[model samples]
Target: MSEGSSSLPLVAIVGPTGSGKSELALQLAERFGGEAVNADSMQFYRGMDIGTAKLPEAERRGIPHHLMDFLGVREDTTVAAFQHMARTAIADIRSRGRLPILVGGSGLYNRAAIDVLEFPGTDPAVRAALEHELELRGLPVLMARLQDVDPVSAERIGDAKRVVRALEVFELTGRPFSSFMPERQYVVPTIQIGLNGDRAELHGRLAARVHGMVDAGLMDEVASLIPEGLREGRTARKALGYEQFLRVLDGESTVARASEETIVATRQFARRQITWFRADPRVQWLDWSQAGLGGAAEALVANSGVAGA
Candidate 1:
């Protein structure tokens, strides 16, 4: 290690779905003496393995991983809880003298893990009211309302869950939700390497990955979880693959249709993720098609001293 390269830059491998972020994180972890900390929201659950494309134990290459396989499928997961856990895992990894590699495509989870992002205090009454409003007037009503109060946030947050959270923040604090974005300041000096893939190629890869997951017993895994109250899980039930497959189990759709929907949704999600990660200027992107990506990332860290310290 060079002078100041003593501590690795709390490496975060972020990118869209099917961009091979997990593989890169594994390679970098093996080479850089690091342990991977899961930042994918879906992968936090214990039995979501096949659908989440979670790396099997044998595939981890003997590198220790943290913050994965701990949550039950029925439990609701919050970013606040994850932030607490992920930060603690990173600190523990550093104390053990190993690098901490944060990996996943869940943008909020990734940001929550490393950025100086704070979660606003929630009021159950406020949250319930928002939830009720979401059920009645639907997303458009809330979106329009948010546009009135915080157009910047309204433009950036596209989903109902996020919009509701932002609205909850605004109603509770009288502040625009966009104002809370941490200006990309890291709680710890961090190196975020985004995997960039060609759009057409990425789409093809995601489609194939969806097929592979289905072939790997995704339906069966989801079936087993139904008894475990997977449907009641506010967060888990909304997961990409699981959500579609649940429709299949409900007899509302065919497996073929579910698979197709998952592929299309995953592709759309990848585009959104690419856009999100690209907006951050701090990310040092790596072209996945390029040769020696792992070596290049190691060089990026080695060349910069005290990056994560």
Candidate 2:
């Protein structure tokens, strides 16, 4: 896209987990007539609630939210698919004369919205073969292969799940995964707001959040999903809190241990998110504890020059 073409005003609220991105997005959307769009991968699935830290409708405070809880636990939703959906949602929101606020901590999703990464087209046969390999050799072997074939992508997509996806694209398209990434200059015009705070404070907040989820019946939510046939579903099985809670349900770990493990894993994930967003120069870092939502919203509006804000 040309500089003029890419200059459309879009607001993106992003950060690591427990950074208070959601609350800030809600406040900004309400104040500026914007719609909150989900950029979190886990929050897309239904019944994966407490583990995803999904914002409930009540918590939305009457501001419109797009792309939350629309898919089943068993469904396979890829980042490319999310990008297509997000493009449509953003266009629709802009068409209706409202701002589009891309929100959450998913770096890939944020990158897709702001950059021109073209996803390799899917092939069922190739996907089946990759899935078979995943089932047989497991994720470590596949991840190792990815590191050999496409080290940049291997570094970017470090986890087992993301490694599988990168390999699937490589196998299907016969192209290096890094080739699909658009050039830096091709990034879309967006006001990127990054929320962050002191690391120790954020960790304490994350632990508290995990405990709060437990108090709010996180285990019961997982238990309910198991009976509804989500016991083997990928979405339910891999979610942070739900996965650990499943271990507790299976009597492999006590609730206390599960909570502790979940908190640790979540903290690690947040650190990864922070690393990813920090590497991107487009984001304008903001300390949520230092500034209120109103101040952040005003700054974003002024910087982006979005009309009617």
Candidate 3:
């Protein structure tokens, strides 16, 4: 690493769900006197603990955590908002002479925290107009339009949510969504670590975790959110565990059926996350079970040229 690169150190722990990322990140924070920051989108909402698998205050092991449970479910917190918050958190942690450890499974959030991705400023009117169009014309129509204007971006963001985002940019700026995004160098030198395991083992773990969540009153959690007027909130309505529970609540499915559906959805999400992270060339992939916490921490520090505390 160059001298300039050596000064700004950020470590990121990324992986599919139930891959032990949170445990590894907490251990690293304890070992290096680091502060933990949430990079998972779902974890940003307050009162979304069990479903998001958030670490409780007691389980935080006395280390300070940033950006988790800081926003309400109804609030519109975008990637730009997260970038701003994470930058401030990182600066604050560094000022206190502590390392910043970003931990979560959200690949986009992880990239925003490390790379200097330019986000177009939020405009509610623009978002509302685009969302109206999406509701009218459907995602396929918007995706077709994106393909015509910016095939690269359309390919990169080939999802309903992303198609809406692209349309929002186009409506807001009268420019192709891709035009505003420039290739960026990392603003903070980062050690990006990805956790992996045998595909069968990962699937097994995911199923077990989903079952555990159900056993731990995931249905009650969803019921509480609904009565709090979160039934229409984008964050709460679409959360992995909460969505399936909603189905159960509506009598559309049995509890067993909901659990099965949740596991399937989570597995699909994990597959997408793996695909996204694998495409990023900067991440160093390792099997979490094989490397263990200590080895992974050492590897991250050594790769980033960050001396051990």
Candidate 4:
């Protein structure tokens, strides 16, 4: 844990979607001789470009980005698996004498990369039973059952899979899922820089971004992925734009309606993201619109007094 192990602190850039997190990460990476380790879960899928807002290679300015576009559309990943992948990428970046700039709006994924978090083991029989119940009784029924046992986890978890997982954990270990929530402690030397702005302005930015993606052929991107098994993907099929576009492919919805639905869902997701990052007291916040924003963020990293810096 000594010597070069502590050479540079892991730098994490976190914020809501459309808050310019990716741009800020690139700036700090370029200024500090760093490479990026992505924490955005959706960006892990290989062809989810325009919808996920994955920075194209030409726009990356030749800086290497890890842990993105490494998964097929039909594949899924757990936070535990992503934690290992992210930490390995960080170590690899550091070993090459480059700081690891961890970037994205996926709060839990980011925390798993740098925080002192541990995942609970799963039980096959318990999982199989819970999944059977999910299939028979539906998600809302399972969610209701989880709320009775672990209300805190119920409040924080929304999706069907996570709700089932929370219940599974409670059953397997006799512990509330929220009891395992990670503290603000870091597993390694790390700093978090958060970007934020006025809510109204962000809403407009997000709406426009969604429209831009639509004009940039998001439908085509979704169409192309169908042949590659987008519908079969548990995680990828549920992504914001991809889900809506899938409806369009099924002729169950119109493009305009799908686009509107995607915008609304993205906004809701962004609100959740904001709430998640704001709960972390260690994050140093900067306005996304701040003048000399890059300099301000760079100063925070430079003055952090971590070994190599």
Badly placed stretches (over 4 Å) of model 3 are 1-8, 291-293
Please provide, for model 4 over 1-309, each residue's C-alpha lDDT reduced to its tens digit, 9 standing for 90 to 100. Answer: 233444678999999999999999999888888889999999999999999999999999989999989999999888999999999889887776678999998877998899888889999899889989998989999989888999998888788778988999999999998888866788778999999999999999999999999999999999999999999998898999999999998999999999999999999999999988998999999999989999999999988864244
> Where does candidate 2 stray beyond 4 Å?
1-8, 185-188
Candidates' TM-scores? Answer: 0.94, 0.92, 0.91, 0.95
Q: What TM-score should be assigned to candidate 2?
A: 0.92
Candidate 2 structure quality by residue, lDDT tens digits, 210-266: 999999999999898886666667655788888899889999998999999999999
Query: Can you write out model 3's per-residue Cα lDDT over 154-253, one digit (the tens) per residue?
Result: 8777556777888778777778777775564677777888888788899999999999988999999888877666687865678888888888999998
- For model 1, name the residue pairs that clash: 4-305, 4-306
Candidate 3 residue 171 Cα shift, in angstroms, is 2.7
Q: What's the CA error at residue 130 for candidate 4, in Å?
A: 2.5
lDDT per prediction? 0.86, 0.81, 0.81, 0.90
Worst 10 residues of 3 by lDDT: 1-10
Residue 51 of model 2 has an lDDT of 78
After the best TM-score superposition of candidate 1, give how far the Cα of residue 140 lies from its true spot, in angstroms. Answer: 1.8
Q: Write the per-residue lDDT of candidate 1 for residues 164-198, one digit (tens) a residue.
A: 89999999999988888867789887888888967
Off by over 4 Å in 4: 1-5, 306-309
Q: How displaced is residue 202 in candidate 1, in Å?
A: 0.1
